[model samples]
Target: MAVIYLVPPVSYTCPNNTTCCDDPTFDTSVFKRTIATEFHLICDKSWLQSFFQTLFQSGVMAGSLMFGIASDRYGRRPAVIVAVMLELCTGIIAAFMTGYWSFTFVRMITGAATGGIMVVTFVLLMEFIGTDKRSMFSAIFHVPFAMGHMSLPLFAYFYRDYVQFQFAISVANVIVLIYICLLPESPRWLLAMNKVNEVVTILTKVAIINKMPTDTIRQAVEQYHINYHVSSIPKGSVADLFRTSNLRRNIVVMSFTWFACSFSFFGMAQYVSYLTGDIFLNVFASGAVCFCACLVAIPMLTFMKRKKAVAICNATCGVCLLIIAFIPDGILGMVFACLGMLLNFLVFIIIYLYCTEMFPTVVRNAALGFSSMMARVGSMIAPFVVALKPHGQWCAPVLFGVLPLISAVLCLMLPETKDIRLMTTLEEGEAIGQSSRKIGTK
Candidate 1:
């Protein structure tokens, strides 16, 4: 949302020319100083807006890979701290940057950190949650993201200046830092890492919080600790994800799902630009709608298996969007488009849960990291997809409608994760839903 807001599409106007200026000026009534305005990135240099986005997304792609490994290698808590610190530092630096080259550089690094925070924090959350309550927690997890999306425009509306807005958002990381500090290390990660003492401490703390029996917690931890050491789960690698047929299929299918979700979700948001509403209000409303979708998803999670949810949402969203391309721009058209948008958001939430439960604990973050990197790739392509507006009005919607349907078909090929335990070893992951054939086996 900040990315779109950073280049205000409506705030500037032509002062003298009857038709919008040949060499457009960024002079508004309030003198809005966006990156577009400050850099005079109007007519010819307009592609720079997409370029800036690409650079940031490229950073996110790299960061997801790097941090995913880092968390697996170092620890989730440490990796999160490092990622957050880098994000804070680069964001602050970007606010002060005057040179376009320098500012974009900072944005890239900041994006990397942001990506790290995103993938790592999610893995951490899923690892902490038990499967029975996973749906509620995962759905609730997206609330802050939607709220931030809703809040960015509010910040942009009041701050108006790029510098002030940049700095203000940078400071929001302080809250993340505090939250990280207060979190207990994931007992799942700890157990897999053979840090049973730490796991015991974390569970003991949890027992204290829930007012459970500490002795029971400690003895249970001891039994698990002894079993863990006896049948220790070996660490995992990205290569391992591809070696086993089941795990390999899961990752490949998930990668496409992630790509489609990112591509379509952002495409849906940007596609709103073609609509007749106020862009700023549209942005806020879009966020609000997504938040409501998250809330509504709570009940849907009760009955919908992960695979079924994704398939249903994707198919329905695709049909609604296809309908949107034909209809006149009216309340009915808007309703269909909004429904597509809402379903895309639900796919995102469900897919996260799907991904978390499919992979084993050892390589879970790595799998998510790779999927997120693909998601970044999808998002990078989204603007260009939206830019297809010049070719045909139907180009964007048709593609949007088609991609999710393809993903819906792919969703069926995936094994169900609803009743399956979160895998702790490569063997466990490979064993999941083995009702499907194992091709390319050695």
Candidate 2:
């Protein structure tokens, strides 16, 4: 999250600042050259900034899909350890690289590592905790990410004169490596891999810490031994994601959600300067407010069902973005921006949780990786739309509104997973997701 908040500004600031500021003498071509060299590290002619972002993010997403397969095949703990180490090394190398190409390649590798880390960490934490408490814990995990997001702009404001922000981000990630080393492996993963001895040992430790009966824990584990054997390998191609079968609907709905939500989210974020009367102060204030709103989402997740909660948030976000589109450049603009920030905070909560819930264990992380790739496609292209010549003050917000509106409609087609158990196979997910809607149980 820290890197997510930092990297965009660092890469695009040269361009964003120049575009917005009414400096007639400033060369737009210089903005393109500086941003491309720094962001892509590709000094090659014909490289566009958006194209580089797409290529970089697609590689990261593919790497994430592979990591998910590795984790599911091997174990979550090993996968996370390897990913974090890679991230730390790549980030440090990125900080010290001499030329644009070297740094860009290093950052691409770093993105890949970070993608794996994100998926494994989330899956591990959810599997480590009990079902009743999973949503609560998952929501808690997002708070630190929100804090990191809010802290990034301040870092950027202070670090503008130096290019050492990359080094600082790398140092912070190294600290993450320390934390990862100390954390325990997921007991669920141990059980799934048929490592009963390890699972028993971990459960015993957990029972002792919680002051629970070891016999009771063992009994629970014994009752859970129904081996509904499914295919270990993912059958078919990436095109299977779009077939008229179970995987297709999930893919289509998820793809739409990913594209729409991301477009709106980044669209609003990119125009933070224009949304409010005083760009600097408003950006700071809105960031803090959004952070608080993220905290509110935790409790909401606990009390409310996931489907209805996400629907409400999406509807609210769409409305807010629409409102922002119409407001003039004054106090009304600030009001609309604040409303949009609140909605964005809520929409983000849904995105994080819903993306994870929408697939089975076999392809769960892979599904997220694919959806995230699509989202990055939206993110890469969204800025350019607002930057297009015909677009003016209202263009960003209008596009933002349009995107979420589509998301709201597509979301209605998805089945709720609030009460459904985490599925372990495609067949199970397809049956449950389809039947859950028919049975009218969210």
Candidate 3:
């Protein structure tokens, strides 16, 4: 599609003393169909392509805030179901869209739905799993995302038509929507809402399924209620994240880290198109590297302190990007680029685990939502940064390299969260950071 959109320049004869070339025009003879060709999204209107992509991130930003609040107020299961339904409907609508503006509108809505599903699902999984197993499960959870990225090129290869590809992706949501019906609401959420009877009922059923003795399950639930005092903690608001001194600093640093991580990761991914090679091959290579990074991340998260691991990942990623900026464009540069992407991908996995552990359960969803919203800002701007490649090849890579390095340094200010109990209250969370600092001083 990109190749077709990049129409070849044609020569025109000059009548008098000078020779001139006509404006490049789409060549339908080579490739007759594509959104670009169909809409004449070429020449001066090419910026619209980037604009269309940006709108999706904008939607994601909006959706994160919307569904984050909704999940906290309603429940994770309901929020996730709504998001899936939105994606299913909007994706189909986007496929049949004939006008460019209409397609862009649907895509923006689709992006929001995608964001809602992702954030809520992450919180749901973290809430259900044991703290010790979270890092491993988080890594496992990301496998499907990496697989989705890797599968896109294969889908495009087999079904070259844009409409067909859209339908193929959209239809999978139907299966998800059906599956969502069977999922139970988060027990932690029920407990937080002071719905003890509901929590007991759910835990009893879970115990029955696992064949655990009913007495043991009852003892565990009684112990949890006494230890955490879950009923006393008030429902959290978004403002609670900023109400205290330590939390304010934590939010500031983590939000910036999210922005940096996302900006660099997406910037590198988008720039693959500009690399000198088959676009499909470049995309596949990038996805493969990211998948490998996910595998490597499993043990890293299991053994290493989350803060140190993230700092190291960010620094190494920065170095790789720097090398790519200097090396001549070819296999070597592509190698460095892929390496940078791999390390950045590791950083992404570690950060998700870190963020999940950092905040208390009360505001966990809201904090994650705010952080993701900051990330969308980074992602939104990434395309424009990549677009700067026409002026200088190194411009985008240098920007991407520098941000993560800054993030690496900033990471040192955040506390290590590995092996600690997930905080259930704001005061407890603030104390953890303070205690870590006091220990550091010794």
Provide the overall lDDT of each model, using Cα atoms, as 2-decimal numbers. 0.81, 0.64, 0.80
For residues 261-352, write the lDDT of model 1, one tens digit per residue: 88888877877755666666777777888898899788878678788899999999899888877877656766777788889999999888
RMSD of each: 3.6, 5.4, 4.1
- Clashes in candidate 1: how many? 0
Give the Å shift of residue 229 in candidate 1. 5.7
lDDT of 3 by residue, 377-419 (tens): 9888887788788788889999999989999999899888887
Angstrom error of the Cα, residue 68, model 1: value is 1.4
lDDT measured at residue 303 in model 1 versus the true structure, 0 to 100 = 78
Off by over 4 Å in 2: 1-56, 227-244, 273-283, 437-442
Task: Give the worst 10-residue stretch by lDDT in candidate 3.
Answer: 1-10
TM-score per prediction, in order, is 0.92, 0.81, 0.91
Best candidate, TM-score? 1
